[model samples]
Target chain A: MAEIKLNNLTKRWGDFIGVDDQSLHIKDREFLVLLGPSGCGKTTTMRMIAGLEEPTAGEIWIGDRMVNDDLPKDRDVAMVFQNYGLYPHMTIFDNIAYPLKVRGTDKSEIRPRVEKAAEQVELTEFLHRKPKALSGGQRQRVALARAIVRTPKVFLMDEPLSNLDAKLRVTMRAELKHLSRALQITTVYVTHDQIEAMTLADRVAVMKNGIIQQLGTPDDIYNNPANLFVAGFIGSPAMNLINGSVTDGMFVTTGGTRLVPVKSPDREKAILGVRADDMHVHEAGQGDIDVTIYAFENTGESTLLTVQWGKQRVIARGDRHLRKDQDDVVGISLNQDHLYLFDPETEDRIEM
Target chain B: MRDNTLKYLLVLPAVLVVFVTAIWPLIEAARLSFTVGRLNRPGSLDQYLGWENYLWAFFEEPAFWNSVWVTAIYTLLTVGLTTVFALGLALLLAPGGRLRSSAQALLILPFAMSPALIGVSFRFMFNPEFGLFDAFFGIVFPPLADVSWLADPQLALAVVVMADVWGWIPFLTLVLIGGLASVPRDTVEAAQVDGASGWRVFKDVTLPQLAPVLAVVVILKSIFSLKTFDQVFMLTNGGPGTATQTLSHYIYFNGMKYGQIGYSASVAWLMVIPMIFLTYAYAKFVFRKADQ
Candidate 1:
């Protein structure tokens, strides 16, 4: 019942388009994530849904009604801003209860509901203290508590955990996932972090240049990216796109080395996309192509080898225990099944 | 020299300047307040009269008490009216764009005029015959059509208060605009999305955050209002049987016109008491913001 439908949504400020014409349907109780780099219109899309930013042209439907002209308050959506936005003058409890108080909820009902929301966010003890007294994480919790204090139709979160430290972000991400699940509200989360999208979202819409580049599950995007942008953006160490052309159905590197056999028709120019994890590292002369290591890094979880392959450098993930030094010769083989072929001119997938 | 001694030495000239420019005048005034300091009488400044001037103003003279009453009411009305109107104007202009910004720039023109000039301009504008505000108010209110603004005792006080409020609103509006700008935009948006109506959002979110600035504004306005002299001196000059006479006008009339310097000095010292308290309060707000 809380599903959101956006039709022909476009936000433009004069010549600069924030969000181009797009349509999306977020299923009820679904945790959909809008993932993109900064200024990619993910936050704009969420704000449009929140009725904060006016759409230059579109129809927005929350629940059964078309809310194109409705104010943010009438939209029945709660948002967690990046800055937390807690009322500094009020105590934490009052901040949480503000929505209820402003709506003229009974004085008798406000306390228990506020207390419950605070308890859910583990902020029960800090209720008496003002927001200025709390740390960054605690203030973020206060913002969360305030959002959940009311049963809104939609929850729009614009990088709620981006302010937290790395360790705290991880913890909060887990807690957020758990909270969203328990609350069972339709949630739209926006973030640049791939892991957060992968772990939390029912579906992720990867966006670029005010357009949704791809919309799919984490596994689908990781395995089958629709374009060069998606292939490059979704993975850490980014998918290595080597400039080459197809000849006799074989993808050749710019240096004229035949890299892999692709299913695409012969093209004058193409780019091969491969994740670092998919490129297997072997000892010199054992693999298909031998390259000198430009850099070797052990991240404890895995070892990364940046290898000099012809004119381009490709990062290969080696086994954690693998020991290597810079300038060491290593063999890097592309996983044939995992390879992505993109048309260099169009930057679209070649559908091999 | 040692560092401590050198620091004191460096500050010595500034302290001396303050003592000469500020402290000396105050001490001289206080000494004069205790004596029969007459402008015409030779060696009358050092003739000690003790608490006679102070007691006479407090107990005997009804003119002094009338001026005190007028000053109090004037201060209250001007401070309250100026602050409320300034806040409204600030809210209107704070969401700035080309037109509103230009309008805000134009608002400074009224405040830039000297207070005495403002008083003269307002007096001219409120004249019963062929006056701009007089005709405007007459057309709007209807009941005030035949009423002469300056000739009536209450209306003269009202005109003076109006002129003061009009002259001061622009500067205060600019300050409040700065205060409104400093309020984090996130909180206001959050309130909007929290299902609060526009009025509710202002009351609960914007107002509480704006409280400190409002406090500073009120305190500042009160101090300035209590010290008001230039406008009243030009506009009303304590006329209509001393109905519009403020403390400063009263002191001027007593000391300069009547040549009773000691009595005027005593009354001026009395006026300094409230200013000291207001100054302390203003200093507290300034220092608190610094601490934060």
Candidate 2:
């Protein structure tokens, strides 16, 4: 319901900084995910926006109002903590009704609101149960219900599904995505899990060391990473990065295997990035790189082939029907169009 | 099998100490309460008295019953005040930041002080002469000069209760503060975001979380208050016409002072019965409920 903007926000503890100078703009009704590794200040950024933590400097504006001085409740935001911090003494009914009660809603209005929120989370039947009596997934639903009952302008979720089992986490992730669209609230979710960020976010803000590494749609981040960190961090089995140089208008690895550039242009010493899906194995062809298979993983429907050339080993996803295990030299073809180049010293993207 | 035997051998010394120091004394006390002995009649082992001393305590001795009532009143007042003050201090101190450690250390300093020292200090302060309380009041009512607080029937008992509260509240507060500190910060933050005010957050989130610890504080303070003797003995010596006399003081008066060993043993038994019942009932009622 409100657009949030952080202008040079920073958080510090004595001499140490939790979140360095960072700036981000979250549009209204957009699901923006702050994704990063642990201790990278994703949660700290979310807490600052929610007014649960104070920023050391700069300002936070929400829907034209500078709310840096406001308390969490005054900021018109509801948060779902990673631990699903439900009051253990209160039943689910009271827990969901707490926000309404605090806001001085009418007695008649509170009942239906609580009921509607509970119904959305599929927790109507367990209304009278305490949090301790509920399972992990059920408790998360209660926490979600508690947030939705208020119908606040913004929803802040800090890795809310991280506590559930793998299957439950998947289910909850889908549920949260669906619920965010239905509620149409400006939501900022923080998670270290890239899969969750990829699936749940309308726009993912990849952060590292308290700074935004890349801020774009999932496809923009996955296909055209702005830097080496994003290119390496955003993908599974990750993008294969190898040190290479431009010679004779062809990208050549240190092992002297020449990769015919799909787009031949200008490049010197730069890191070459290629996705696993873009690479095709060639036994022998016009444009092929010879490499010996190091290992192969069969994951039911697909197989991952890890090949070593010189000191470099890169994993490529392939069809289970095509490749088996370690064998003789295999020929591989690279999708030159999808290849990314990064300057080795700066770790910054270099124009190809 | 060798490891199990070695583990048992390691704990043998602890088991022996429990048997000799704890269980043996309890058994001896039970046996002695059933027998009769006097200083002069120590050589004769045929002095067997069953429930006569108990009967005398309950019916024949009016002063004994009065002492019981006084002790009960003092214990209840001391425990009740201490529990209330301790819980309040814990709530105020548990949220610590920069000043938290200093505040906690200062609060616990009173408990670290010796009870005998506390008694002497309070006695001197409340003394109607050049003492603090009297001197402060003497500015208003100059007619009040050197009024003996320990000699007054009502003031003597009040002073003992006050001294006990000062000595014991810090201990209860420290325990409750540790318990309150463990109340999840996540739960409290959730409540705050849910639009709960300060009082509501404490009532719904903190109070329920601290129930088990508060129960412990109350029970421990009650047990200590019931057996209180140091402050009263050091200050008033159970004087002011038996006004400040507790059961422990009465037992001391009979056994050591008057040398009525048989009678004193009976009074001690009379006191121990209620304490045993209380300990059992408290563990069953409050502590068990808290565990759930």
Candidate 3:
């Protein structure tokens, strides 16, 4: 397995910059995901690493060798395209066996390798079937099998799981993570789906525009975001950002709602970031903020209540039976230790 | 009752047209095959000949058999050569860029021109003494300078075939272009990534996808080439000892030109049998295989 490093890579089409100057180092056997919205250059970055696209500037190094001039095959890398570009005319056997046969591997070795790979993907029964005869999930398995059969140095997957149904996607996500670990190959995966990136990545690099906004372990990027963009982009019900000013070293909202700063008192006059699950709701007099519970949704395991503190909406996760349309005075309390402080002007974190 | 009558009335024109134009003529032709009277004569139900005309056309008539052989040779030669040339051009121009539309327009110019114009133009170009064809070929073949292309009984048929190829290859090329263009670009790229070279990609990925379209072009070109009359009429007028006389030309010469209506109708029967077989074979082999 090889570690891949992008040294200030940038891609531009005419005047429009597809990927801004970005640098990242993916460790050996690491499952690194570049996650962003569409047009955020996540796929472009993976393509540059795969040698399918040329970066407008900078170099890509796989292990010790600079691979900017190498073709995809020469770089010892394989890609599972989003469309699962299987040769429609060939059977699944030939599709999975192609790379081996192309490298001029011996005829005797090709059959075993193909069967082994197919068995790993649980596709032994489909070896004789054409791609048109297979379902979407089966086609995905074939693409995965094709990538793994050669045991290349790196695997580049561009939204490979996006085509499968939601249930299949979850199953395939877990399988891909396990397979990456078992094979111990460096993989650079690109997807706009935040959940896939969170579940499959050893480390997630959240991007915006064409620049890397944050690069850290999934927990670090989620719990400790570097900027407003990262804080807003990583979470599902999304992290709540309330506009407030530091008054006497405490963050107070426009409606005079106060929050205990988990950060040091020196970082004053900043925005407060809190996770939706971190806020607790109680009877009006027992909490710091007197908010109204506007709506509640029961997610089977827990109730998610949308509380309005002053003019802003905040979500609270709890086990209380709050009615969906009930308007009741509620008390809100912060988690105390997990609150984040970001500079109001720059939107960057104000760490104490 | 009203709705049923309205539906039947809506379809009445088409049903009546098919019965009058197609099924009626077929039934009449089958009946005429056993008759002893010509088409211009008042046909009588009493004139029962009982398949004598079929026997005479097949075994006794030399010109009818000669026409059959000539038509078969012309169809095979024209369709075979046209298919090869069209496929070659389609391969060259299908994966096109800046020059694609211009090449397509140039290729389609032949199909847009009338076949009679095509034939006349070819005849003037292939004239023995004054034609540019002899001069151009004389530089390469060298022996073509001494040969009279139209007057020679042996080469007159070859000239007709060449004329038909020029007039018809464009349609086949156009059809195959649609086929080749529709071969998925992603599949081609996948083959390349699977380590196939240019020729292998075409043979493995492209040829299989193009088989149905190629079959249609071949069958249609064969049918038209078998009945080709415009080029033969304008170029040689079926001269040089009937060497260039095809089935359609034979029908024209006998029924209209010579007024041997009964004999020509009998010759027409022989031609329809192969056409029926070819159409059925194509539907079975090519289109059925494609659907499967």
Candidate 4:
């Protein structure tokens, strides 16, 4: 079993830190996602683990070996790049057979193993064709089959699905999930898309500015976000962070409305993070407060109402059948249990 | 005018320029090749000889066959040696930094100097008594110190090949550097992470992808090497007993020195045949890449 450990790993290009003193222990057979915005060091961390980028300080241990100075080939790792990076001149079968061939696998053994990997990725039928003749999705499958042909110690994927179209992305995401389950290898996946992280990762390490901001499971990170960035980053529509201040154990909007009470004491400035789904949509004056809708959108599955709350606009999700128009006044009420409070200065969650 | 007509009209100037500078001269040369064209006899320009000049150059001339052999071996040696050295230099200078960038900038200096000038300079450096290379080879190898580089038959040919290769490597190396740059970095990295050593990555991934560009380089270098004339003229003047007399030098000797214009034109037309095939091959690569 292979487990990856990065102990105080730091990568700096002059003054700009790529991965700043980061330490992470990924368990054996666990699929850990390094998730962040662009330039947030997620990809850099994965590259260092893959031995593609050298760390300026500290050690990287894969299994029992301190492989800080090992070359990428010597580390026994496989990576899927964003662009698929298939050998354009090679047939699909040859592409899948490259790792085995390079490792000096038996000539007779290469054919059947390549066929098996191709069958797993559903590329067996197209084995004779070169990569140039394949579609984008087929090329991506060739990359997948190549990585899985030889069972390397760890699998590293850098935004492997980012190049596909939206519908193809969904289909490939399911395929990737199935493949990772069957392979059961230690995988380090890097992506900026929170949905992929939430769906595929056993645990996601959310990063910002070269530092790991939070490390937890999907449910833990989604429901109990560690900071304002995580709360704003992990959701589909993104959690609504309303600007306000906490006064006398009560949250007050910037427009001077004394809203729901929070457990934290008074603070000069605070941000209240509330997801759109947490707020219920009721008819005018029937809920906690009546507000006019600034914009109304019907997403087919659910309707969204951007309501004018005092002076600021906060969105509320309604049922698919709930039809409302612009300037339509609707009543809104907060789910008191699901609300979160954060310190504006530190951007950290105010644990209460 | 309609769009189709306007498109052709816009390109008409370039077409006329090509016709005037290239096509017209080719047609005139073909016409001249069929006659007994001589400078002293004014009426001989139109006196029809009908394949006599071609037959003489093909069957009656021993010096013509000698030049052909010299040119064939010359093209082979220069193209092969230049491409190998250029590919090495391109790889060394491809991963550029400030020092390497200045080094790359320095490579352009030799290429900027005229070929005729390079041949003249090389002649001076290989002089037996007090030449730079003569002294250096004397100290380094001892045997070559007393040997006159331009005095022997085989050695003169070797010196000519060296001069041509040295003059051409900078341009080919720059083109190869561009080709190496266009090879996708992702594929190389993918090979590395797929358990390939650096040498294997180059052989398996980088070289295959660079094949088309390499083919283009070889074809371009072959065409240039076949047409080499100025260096041979200035360096040995086809000397050490005509050891370095290429096809162009042979034609110039027959046409300008002996005043046998029709014979030289027939031989020049014979030279044009190989060029046509090479130009066709070069066009195929250019169009194939465009299609992609």
- Chain A TM-score for predicted structure 3: 0.95
Candidate 3 to native Cα RMSD, angstroms:
4.0
Which CAPRI tier for candidate 2? medium
User: Clashing pairs in model 4?
Assistant: none
Question: Highest lDDT: which candidate?
Answer: 1
Compose the digit string of candidate 4's lDDT tens values, residues A1-352: 5999999999999899999999999999999999999999999898898888999998999999999999999999899999988888889898899999889999999999999999999998999999989988999999999999999999999999999999999999999999999999999999999999999999999999999999999999999999999999999888988889989998999988888889988888999999999989999988878889999999999999999987778888999999989998998889999999988899999986
Q: Per lDDT, what order, best first? A: 1, 4, 2, 3
Q: What CAPRI-style quality would you assign to candidate 1?
A: high
Candidate 4 chain B: 10-residue stretch with minimal lDDT? B283-292
- Which regions of candidate 4 deviate over 4 angstroms? none
Question: Model 1: what is its DockQ?
Answer: 0.83
Clashing pairs in 1: none
Candidate 3, overall lDDT?
0.83
i-RMS for every candidate (Å) is 0.7, 0.9, 2.6, 0.7
Q: After superposition, how far is residue B67 of candidate 4 from its true place, in Å?
A: 1.1
Clash number by candidate, in order: 0, 0, 0, 0
lDDT of 3 by residue, A1-352 (tens): 9999999999998898989989999999999999999999998998888776899999999999999987665778888889898878789999898878777899999999999999999999999999999999999999989989987888889999999999999999888888887898999999988888888889999988899999999988888899998998888778888887777668887666666755456444667888888988777789877777788788877788888777888888876565444587778888988888888889898784
Per-model TM values vs. the true structure: 0.97, 0.92, 0.84, 0.98
Better of 1 and 3 by lDDT: 1
Q: What TM-score results for chain B when candidate 1 is compared with the true chain B?
A: 0.95
